[model samples]
Target: MIDRRRVLKALSKYPVYSPPFHNSEAVLSRSEIAANYNYFLEQKARRLEFLASYLRHFFVELSLSPEALPALDNWLLRYGGHLIPNGGEVLFAMNDYEPAWVGEYHGVNIIHDISIFAGDYIVMKNDKVRWSVNYGDGTKRDYEEIGFGQPCLVGLSHFAYTGNYSIFHGIYEFCYAGLRRLRNGGRGSKWERDIPGELVRRLNYLADPDPPPQIPVSQLTIDD
Candidate 1:
């Protein structure tokens, strides 16, 4: 087992950024821009640490093995889901477009989910099971396989409804359950309000946490 505390501590060193470039013409120097970009990259690097720590906690809490956790991590990263790695195998699924999430453990790519929407979730298998419905006229859908360790990615649009509340709530619930299962063992309570502060803090960092890489503005020679 990896040392959770060390992992978190290392992750803390990773950088976090706000914004350095506000306007198009700021009259900034190359060194300054480079510095800012470096800061941004550092922040992203730090996020990787945060992700690793969260995964460790989630795994221990759920009594899952290290092997099982990586599969979940890959799913998060490949699909643009945020999480970081400690000193383990790391792998990434790549494309011209953003992945739904990505995961890495012991430097190996274990899970990947590629989706376009925010309210998307991946179904791993088709077990022919009857799934419960929360809204959308109380309709139920059956699948051949649903869970983890089977498919590289699954779409959740099939579960969407017509109403905004139903769509948002259902998608939120689906993501929360998927995340919880990936790290923690159980699902969170079904609340129609906002997520808790702790979760928010973690997620906020995950969203737009890193700065942009610096580029040499002087190298450009525009032809008029």
Candidate 2:
């Protein structure tokens, strides 16, 4: 369970800035902006640590391996195709692995932390766009949809047991909030609800137990 209080605290302190909302728009110096961006990233990194601790308890109870936790951390730091800065040294590569819109946009990058119920996977595309979801066969769904530059959070469940179950349950709530924020021109809309309900239904099928053997009705009639 994510600490509601902690998440609220982080959300309250999250930095705010106004920048032209286009990839080609010119802004301030890269050096100055980068400095502030690094500071913001540090705060996000700490918040991720908090989320990881919360997830650890769940993993232990389920007897699942915790190896995927580190990848989750890495995903957040580099999520949405932005690299973290440490004294001007790039900590990770944002090449084929980053979202497409990173270089296309000229402002502060957003961080989206995704936790799937099952499977261990990560993706990094250029800054233009990126998509990730669990398909229920140890394979993850990834793609770049049209209209990629918009700030959004998307979730998909092709298997009921995939991704964070709690998050899955709150999909509608998250989606409604995201849409509302987008309409109001909020800084960034939290995309918890962009997932399709149909997808969720299909995913439940993947998680279902094996079906029972079929019996011929004719055999029963003959016995009667």
Candidate 3:
């Protein structure tokens, strides 16, 4: 059986995260930022092996039998109950988006977004990468992240959007789990506290570890 509580406990230990400290002088210090980046790199070092193993095994299992893959209905029933409530409940929720392989970079996959926004590229070697060239949105500073946007907390130039679609897909799963936790037990009839809580939790970079509830929630209303 899945130990949800234990999973939450493990998730709580993610690195301390905050909004992009845009004005912080330390953002320019490659040395200081490098220090924090190294810390995050160390943490990633530990997870990389396990993730690689899991991905390798997943492909192996899928190759063994394509039928082993769960259908969309089963996927939703298993985890989509509360996360995707409305139009999101539909299959292929991201049908509006498209992924294109623009070219190869140093033998890595260079995926470009064509149909969506302006167009950005993700050049990933193997299963990981440290940076990319993001030309789609000028508002988001860090298209080239140091370590999955962990550096963004310090006012770094770019938020960390790493890997490829796989990593983005993984974030969706984590968000789903966060929504699951928000529900009182597994009964996610409707969103109450969990909606805002999940959003804030996602902002803080730790879905399991709760953030300090001191300011934002009190001032804003649904109408705002």
Per-model TM against the reference: 0.21, 0.23, 0.27
Candidate 2: residue 180 lDDT (0-100): 50
lDDT pick, better of 1 and 2: 2
Give the TM-score (vs. native) of candidate 2.
Answer: 0.23
- Give the lowest summed-lDDT range of ten residues in model 1: 142-151
Residue 60, candidate 3: how far off, in angstroms? 10
Candidate 2 lowest-lDDT run of ten: 89-98
lDDT of 2 by residue, 1-224 (tens): 13323333333423332222222333223343344335434444454454445434334222123444344332222221221221221111111112222332211122222322221121121122122321122222221221122222133223332232332222223333433544454334334333223223322333333423334688878888
- Cα deviation in Å at residue 172, candidate 2? 13
Error of 2 at 10 (Å): 11
lDDT (10s digit) by residue, model 1, range 1-224: 24334433433433332334321233334454354445434453344444445445434221123333334433332221123243222221111001212223211111111111111221112222212222122223311112111111222222222122222222233333444443543334454222333322322222222423334455554421
Q: Report the lDDT tens digits of candidate 3 across residue range 1-224.
A: 14333322332332222222221222223344345445533543333333333223224121112232232223223333233322233112221111111111100110011100001011111122233211223335443332222322111212332222233333344335444654546555454323333322332232112224434554776437
lDDT (C-alpha, whole model) for all candidates: 0.28, 0.30, 0.28
